[model samples]
Target: MDKTEILNNICYTKLVYDRINKKLKSNYSKTEIETLLFAILKETHEQDFQKIGKNFYVSNVRNNIKITINSNTYRIITVDRLIKTKK
Candidate 1:
């Protein structure tokens, strides 16, 4: 019922983490992982980048950088907005 539980229950969360972890372990930087994760999230949900952003985070601003996944593009800012990415 908590935020953590909801995120865990979502298939995209697990897939996103797995893909992002693999990317991270394979020499990708934090920004690159963020970008990759964003793209994967969009692809997995079969949604546009804008919709994905609105559902996933409190803020809706697009990150300056973009990434491609399954031939679709997405924009991501950070891995953890509630903590590491808080401004």
Candidate 2:
């Protein structure tokens, strides 16, 4: 499926947007966030999924992109880029 279609399947809450803005300070628009999420989900098999708690998952997409999600609600809790570690 296309990125837009993939994004349409997921849900996002206001808290998610707040966290993204506060944590990343990128001022990313909703469309931008959706696009990024689409890219991440598209590579599902390659991404890392960790169970943080009941019905909650943290998905590490690639080396940088990461997102926390509530499986039951399908709500995105947060989205941010990982800091690069020095080798």
What is the per-residue lDDT of model 2 for residues 2-49, given as tens digits with 9 covering 90 to 100? 333334557887667767878777788988877767667656653256
lDDT of 1 by residue, 1-87 (tens): 123332233333335544545533465655665555545443332232322423433222243222322212222223432223557
- Count clashing pairs, candidate 2: 0
Q: Model-by-model lDDT, in order?
A: 0.37, 0.63
Off by over 4 Å in 1: 1-24, 46-87
> Which residue pairs come into collision in candidate 1?
none
Residues forming the 10-long window of minimal summed lDDT in candidate 1: 68-77
